[model samples]
Target: MRKDWQNLAPAHGLNALVENGTIENLEVKDHVANILETNGVDLNDVEGVIWSHWHFDHTGDPSTFPSSTKLIVGPGFSEVFTPGYPADKNGHCLESDFAGRELQEIDFSGSDVTIGRFKAFDYFRDGSFYILDAPGHTIGHINALARTNASPNPGFIHLGGDSVHHAAEIRPSEYLPLPESIEPSPVPKLHSNACPGHIFAPVLKDGSKTEHILEWQDPWAEFVEPKFGLIYNEKDLRETVRKDEELDANRDIFTFIAHDWSLKGVVDEFPKSLNGWKNKGWKETTRWLYLRDFQAAVV
Candidate 1:
């Protein structure tokens, strides 16, 4: 997977490629279809492909999937993104992608189910999986919360699709404050095996005191500022992120954003079950990994 991702990395670099969208890029060798095939899953077995939004990155080459596979999307999707590129010249998706597939749009207004201030739909109608109305990044942006385990103690995994660009945007909250020390050292060259939390005080947001790192402060300004800015609605995005933070605070819930690069080699890849993440201590080990990017500020 890493090799495939490396192949997709723009030769001109991400920023440059973004600036010049017309540049011919390398072919994406690692499509979901290929991955499923590698895992012994047949293309015809895929029931549906749930799109978080209409973004080019999230919406892969849907043409690769069998026509029997349904294409599911959030509310307001068909009104804007349907008929795709050639039919709607300004559209970001291609007509071939939805050619013979059933395009289903989710409507949350009819469902009274609420999960942490966001309207939710029970996909299975059994409370095991939920599709959350998490708009802000785009017109029909959505998220998923899956019940990983069920018993006296339940564990959930929140698939926060583009809710925030990075984990720091919603972390270091009052519930999960930065620890006094971070193990596996975010910056191994600067610290031994464990990095002291106070070393990061210099990079804290303005008006955030050194003590705030150890104990989260009200008005919560300890997170790193997001670098990218293509947010459709900043206000609504902030609210969505705030609600995500509430879920992240819970130890039983493992929440991850789509673009958290820090989790690359840390977690188990596809074909391997992530159900044992809690027992493996993945959350604790990966919590402060993003701080490595702030090493220069502290130095």
Candidate 2:
């Protein structure tokens, strides 16, 4: 796009790429309706949709839905982003998404209900689902927590909207150690959770000027650097990660980083509730699967 490119929002940027033949045959889809139709579910009954934050990827094509369907977001969302796109010109969202719908922003500032370290609000008031105060990736970034099961031991599914990008972000730590063995699926099942080899990164001595600097190497795992770091608040983001990792450590909670592609074949998709995750052993089965991604990086 030239200087005259009026719309540069995430979706528009991507669409422009395709339209200009810079990218071809890319699938621009209405995934929301497709999933509902495939599952024999009615799309009209959708009361509303909750966006984890204001980022475009999470904020899908809400304009495709009926105007009666409300738009829900986390705290500070409206204050920071509203009167979207054409209305504000600098806005990243489309006004059509919330044009005639109710906008519900979850404000946990004065809430008394605290789940673990997060000030939480039960969306259903049934203690089964909650919106967590997650901040770091972006302002008003929030995560969801759902009680998966009840019985001898309760289980939870943590919907990490965008807190951690890679498994390495919260893995191989004191709480969750690398597995000695794993068994994946397909054919005889992807057994032997082995890697091509390990890579080591040298710990450079600080301010080393001479060749006499000596330091041992440490095993390296690269977690994709977070794009927007603490534009919201460093203290709040660090606190969020601290609590998030604690949740990752607990065996009862299965944290799903929304963008981790390694989970494609591991967990259940939409329309199908994730309530049986414990019985399915999803947390353990997909724990070491991320290593599959690094297989291609080896020479």
Q: Could you give candidate 2's per-residue lDDT for residues 1-299 as a string of tens digits?
A: 11212333543354555678966755434556565767887768888788887654577666666787788888777876687777787666677668888998888977788777888988888888899988766777889888888757899888887776666556554555443333552112233433322220121123221111221111111322232222345466656766777788788999898777878976888867888888888887786566555443332
Compute the lDDT for candidate 1. Answer: 0.74
The runs of at least 3 residues in candidate 1 whose Cα sits more than 4 Å from the true structure, single-residue gaps closed, are: 1-27, 207-229
In candidate 1, what are the lDDT values of residues 50-73, reduced to their tens digit? 898765567776778899998889
Q: Residue 130 of model 2: what lDDT?
A: 90
Consecutive 10-residue window with the lowest summed lDDT within model 2: 209-218
Clashing pairs in 1: none
Evaluated at residue 12, the lDDT of candidate 2 is: 39
Clashes of each: 0, 1
| Global lDDT scores for all candidate models | 0.74, 0.65
Lowest-scoring 10 consecutive residues by lDDT in candidate 1?
Answer: 211-220
